[model samples]
Target: MSTTTAPPQPALPIRGFAEFLGTALLVIAGVGTAVAAPDTGTLGIAMAFGLALLVLAYTLGPVSGCHVNPAVTLGLLVARRIEPAAAGVYVVAQLLGGLAGAGVVLAFRSGDPSFDLSADGLGANGWGAASTGGYGLSSAIVVELVLTALLVLVVLSATARQSNAAVAGLPIGFTLVVAHLVAIPVDGTSVNPARSFGPAVLTGGTALEQLWVFIVVPLVGGVLGALVYRVLRGSDSDAASQDTPDPTTRAGS
Candidate 1:
């Protein structure tokens, strides 16, 4: 008798590259909007992020789920939708994309006579004296955590059931708008680690010093949201049932 082993699956480099490109687009479009239009006001900035998400979700949602945020990746990992290895890769790609996006913004700013990287900080997130709304770090943390939690919840619900698939992009984008509406004043709405990392790298100093809060809070909230979603869907024990398409799939479609 001869023994044979299954061949390893080929790497999906396209997926990884797609993730990188998609996240870059997200951060560039979003952060760029903030910097270019600092006078655009809160609602305008919110729209920038919301519109970026709406476009990216539709364009990359099918390809790589269009996470664009490390918290979202962690959320899916906690939900067991993605393996640890894959999640790691996704996060790395997202970070690279973020840096690239911020780099693009910096390049553009270089041409402007009044552009001061240190003074502007490229829209970095912060709290208290550094905060746009003068909210304390503690308040900023709470706002980021809760907003990320709610954002993840919307992502989970929209992507899980097939019925809502049609409007999934709409809700996902809108949820971001809502999150920004609340948390922008608190911490510039850094529910996305990649988004935070870019401007910090460019801005440095206090922005870099306070980077950890953005990373920690959103991840914690993501894990909590995933756990809540799993519990509600009864996926802890009934793995088979959990894998089944949600009944509302058709209805939502």
Candidate 2:
């Protein structure tokens, strides 16, 4: 008896659509939570953003790895999980997705009674007096750098290692929860440059003026995390070793 083999499945264009939609949902839900429930306070805002990431990641993980954050892409680049060209593309997609999400939020505010875009700000990050909790520039820098490092570290370990691939999404999402829990009170928890860029472009005030901190610090932290992960993973050895296991085989080929 002869057996027939099934044809390989072609990737659907809808997967790309899922990427755009998922990131938009993330930004809208996260920023909307902050806007609608400002009185709910920092913890609430943190949870909003965290939950957004969690849901979005699960929804899009199989399709695009759910890299809604530019810093995460940068981290992946540093760890050599993706090509430099791919990292640049991911960052651009994330920024565009974020802008779309923020635009939706802006539309919602147009008819609200208390909607003052200028006063409320666009959820952009800042430092010193610009910071939500009066954190200074230097203090904000250190806090953002450290927290972003931790965020990227979690991403690197959870997603990059073959051992953790099966359950990576849960830990990765929870990492964002933890990062937001710590950083929300400082700079509104902007570990993602694309997240900050969207709102700052819309607000066009201090949010725009202080956008540099949100972009620069998180990027620096991402690269640092990538390098650290590469060193720890013994990446060069894995690449250079002739005894490396073939991914499709259970034993040495």
lDDT of 1 by residue, 1-253 (tens): 1132223332546556767887888787778888887788778888888888888877766666678788888887777666688778888988899899999988887788998888877888998778988899889889888888888877876777444456788888888888888888888888888899988987999999998998899889888777777778774423422432421111100
lDDT of candidate 2 vs native?
0.69
Compared to the true structure, candidate 2 yields what TM-score? 0.84
- Tens digits of lDDT, candidate 2, 1-253: 1132323321434434555576678889888777766887877777777777777665676566677777777776665555565556667777888889889888886668878988877677777666778887787788778878878877766664334445666676777777777877787888888788888899887888888988899999988876776677675523412121211101000
lDDT of each: 0.75, 0.69
Q: On a 0 to 1 TM-score scale, where does candidate 1 land against the true structure?
A: 0.88
Candidate 2's clash total is 0
Query: How do the predictions measure up, each by TM-score?
Result: 0.88, 0.84
